[model samples]
Target: MNTQEQTQLNMLKKALMQSQYATVIAQCDDVLASLTSPEAMREARYCKAVAYRLSGQPDLALHDLQQLVTDFPDYGRAYQEQGYCYQRQGEDQNATYAFYQATRFNPALLAAWQQLEQAYQRDNQIRALQLAQQQISFLTSLPKPLLGATDLLHDGQLFKAEQVCRQYLQANKHDAEAMMLLAEIGMQLKVYSDAEFLLESCVTLYPDNDRAAAAYQALLSKLGKFPQAVKQARRRLQNQPHNMTIQAGLAHALVGVGALNEAIELYRTLLADQPARPALWVALGHALKAAGDTVGAIEAYQQAARQAPDFGDAYWSLANTKTYRFDDAMIESMVVAQHGSTVKLEDNIHLCFALGKALEDNKQADQAFSYYQRGNALKRKTLRFDISRTEAALEAQQQACQAPMFAQPGGCHAPDPIFIVGLPRAGSTLLEQILASHSMVDGTMELHDILGIANSLSHQGNAYPFNLARLSDAQCQALGQQYIEQTRAYRNGAPFFIDKMPNNFIHIGLIKRILPKARIIDARRDPVACCFSGYKQLFGEGQEFSYSLRDIGRYYIAYEKLMNHWHRVLPGQILTVQHEAVIDDLTGQVKRLLAFCELPFEQACVDFHVTRRVIKTPSSEQVRQPIYRSGMTQWQQFEAHLGPLFDVLGQRTNR
Candidate 1:
């Protein structure tokens, strides 16, 4: 209340308003040091704590809040601030308790109610819905909407959600929730400019709303304003020191801006508390790996596995990490455990495929083959297109590829590049790893560049058949140019790059015409084994192809027929790397593979895993180890369970 104290307080407030959090923190600290009156000191401590929290120093903020509550239990704001700090630290239980205390002291504190609801939602407690409903009811009885138009935005109905929010905002033009909701709706619609405007409005109107702050930070991140995002995240964390979500968001922004060390520190702090969160563990593991702390990364992954035993990602990472090692018993055990535990046939197939890789890594060729076979068997049952239909498509594609190119002249672009195409989980990734290890070859896993080009060329009015042969010579040339340009992004100036889009099997004809200089490598496994493997693996997104068994099998059969046709027409243009053949003659096959790619043999190529390169594939772990023979015959163990698959394979015995 004195002039000097008032001056210091005003400076702190001004610093916060300008988002100069560090200055605010310093000002608060100076004022606190000079305060003598108990009431004034309490106020100064609160301000300092707020500043600390905002500066990404939540532990210090929590300490101040805790001391304030201990000294004055009736302080509602202190309880609310303490709850926020606890939430940021991911101490949900403590955060809930603190929010309850805040509500008990001041029932009308809507921020406390909102924080409590978020805590419940984060924990996935059913009571969260009831609490949200209660908050909504309280607002409904008010003459004016205290929040904004966007407060009415619900899940599942985007258009209706927007309309409700807009109507609410029309009635109360100054509603922060409505502005925030409009921003959210804009973000959803990919209208970044609109969203940014609304978020800015919300921040200006409701400076105290941490949700607005969080949203503003997210918008800044979207706009590539990482420094601003980091600043905002730090400030928001001060308001709620314990919140893991805020910490994670801040860490992500830091990582985006290449501040790996800082991000690592933040992740490490988060992990120290909730060491069991698989996502946090995975993120920390990735950061440590990027920092070249392989041992530390492994330890983090192991801890993640221990915490969430059924988490497939942890096991997958572990399996991949050990794929090149001579002893992959741990990988085998995890894969087998995964296979045994999951009732979904697809899950088992993926486990079997991984098991095959682990077995191969361990030099168990016969067992590896069996596992590979089992994976393929499962795959055959789920494909969408039949063998006959695929064969017909392949015939058409071959004819198209063979047709003379008169438009651009120069002998139809000269197919000089090698492509490894197949359905996913059919040893395509493994094959790419092996070939990429060669001195003259570079492997680019599953690039979308080629497919995107093919898609554009195939567009003829409304009737797009998803068939490659439907495209013309001119279209193919244009597509080929697009593919080359797109792939230029991934090219490390290597002589040869592998375009291993598994679905590129569908566009072999288009690829041949566009890059007539490209060679084609079809990575084939037994249909049953491939199909089964496809069934078992869980893709993160955009694999609508794996939703059913029969669809997968048909897709495989179609791929096989096309590959076969390409072989007959293009002849030596396409090389077949049978999964079994590769396993049977590792050295001989690799030498042959090197000859095909016109690369001089190197002993180092045989031990490819030791060569460090950025591997962006699911098999990153497997490629790190030396070659082994474990994956040769892994299907026999699950023979009883694969009757349908076996029947289909039985009919294809002639092939």
Candidate 2:
């Protein structure tokens, strides 16, 4: 925003705070007329609409807010004002949906959350009401500055949020809520250790704060500290025997620890009392699928979709199973639910993906690609991804790291981790499954420890790889040991574990600097196939680059460049495994991979589909069956929609 527009906005805020609605409306109109920037105009329109609503001109307010939201879909204040206007016009359903959009866009909006709770309660929407209550309780405990930080975080302004929270903390040293909020921002930025330290401090300072405790446990779980998180959840549950929140926490932790039977039973017990909860049903379905109970999982997912037609996760869960087929009626229902403006942004995105899958299954390639494009476009609007930053980081790694850096041999000597790294949808999961099938290798979730260590050394101006030169041998060894110790909870006494975080391909130098003995595998696939596959899939979090075809292709180009640099700097350090090579010769490729990991060959590795481990990727169901060549050609069906990817890949697009 320009200086003049900012001044006008500040004046509008003051007028609204002082209940000068006429002044707010008039000033907003004048400022909007003078502003040419879309952002400035949106801000002005927001102020005017709110003033109109407060002045009892709700219809006019709704019209203006609707236009504002259509132009800028991520504006939370506009959605909240639209909710107010809808409520004034006696349209309770529209009001509820608008309120939901408000909270979804900016979770720190306490008023939006409270209004949603009341709307849900009035309509007796049991599951929605419970979720809104939990959100309200969580937000109400945060400090005011931290609440603003949360809104900034949700708006994809990470650096600004961190700055505000850090400034608040510098003045108020003992504020637990500010620390927790900052920790959350750290997690979102992929700096896991800072998040861990902050959450640890918050829990110590405010032991009675359940929200902080829950967030701390969740961070631990994300770091693959399953045992510690489960233990903490159990202790909390024991203290508060009737607390459903603690019970739910335990159920989630149990899933993390691979105790599928216990988790399923706990979910069933919980659902017996609150069967209307769609999220619980989705959780149960996940557990059942992990336990190889496909029929039971399908029934649970169907139940969830039936109870809450607008709950996008439930429908997406069914589609993500890979084996489940959406019937015609179900597809029609999704299409109808996605058409209205009042549908939540997330729900609409989910419907787009679900519809894409349904049409793809029916061989309607053109229609399927349309839905896929819409879904990606909608999702991309909410993410803060800069391709140039990624390219610069890769360039920095090439300039700073040389072959001599590896000659020092200055990291921890433990060969406990085998990392499978590459682009998403590039067959890393399949490789992990094969290696995890070995008795000596434990398969864990995508561990964030290495990324955490690398991110701690990064600054806004200087990317990683450039930051590694400042670390001494002692510091490197300590960081390596910290990773091993923190990840011990995810192991079952195996000699080695696999951390298959795909994005770790960017941090190969750091991984080698810290854990010199760790094995690295580069999982590669056809560029077009991989990028297009990622474009069609919907990730729960992260992987923002995959939401656009051009972004995905550019990311692939950078990834290929970095991997080539790694090979040049540290030759013979990484084992390159082609996805097609594995499919064509499973026996030989399995032996080659085992040789790279320095492990004895076993039948279990070859018969990986029957190994009975928990798989947590989009390819979960695909890996549960025998290896097939179908996915290699799946992208060809929509080749017309993938010209940008081919353009980026150039000669690399040859299949």
CA lDDT of every candidate: 0.65, 0.86
Find the candidate with the highest TM-score and give its number. 2
Q: How many backbone clashes does candidate 2 have?
A: 0
How would you encode candidate 2's per-residue C-alpha lDDT over 381-500 as one tens digit per residue? 666577888788778888888778877757788999999999999999899999999999999878777776776777534656776766789988998899899888778899999999
Candidate 1 lDDT, tens digit per residue, 116-235? 777777778787658655974665554443233222232222455577667777887967767776778776654565677788788888879888888999877665456668888988
Total clashing pairs in model 1: 85
- Kindly provide the TM-score of model 1 when superposed on the true structure, using C-alpha atoms: 0.52
| TM-score for candidate 2 | 0.88
lDDT score of model 2?
Answer: 0.86
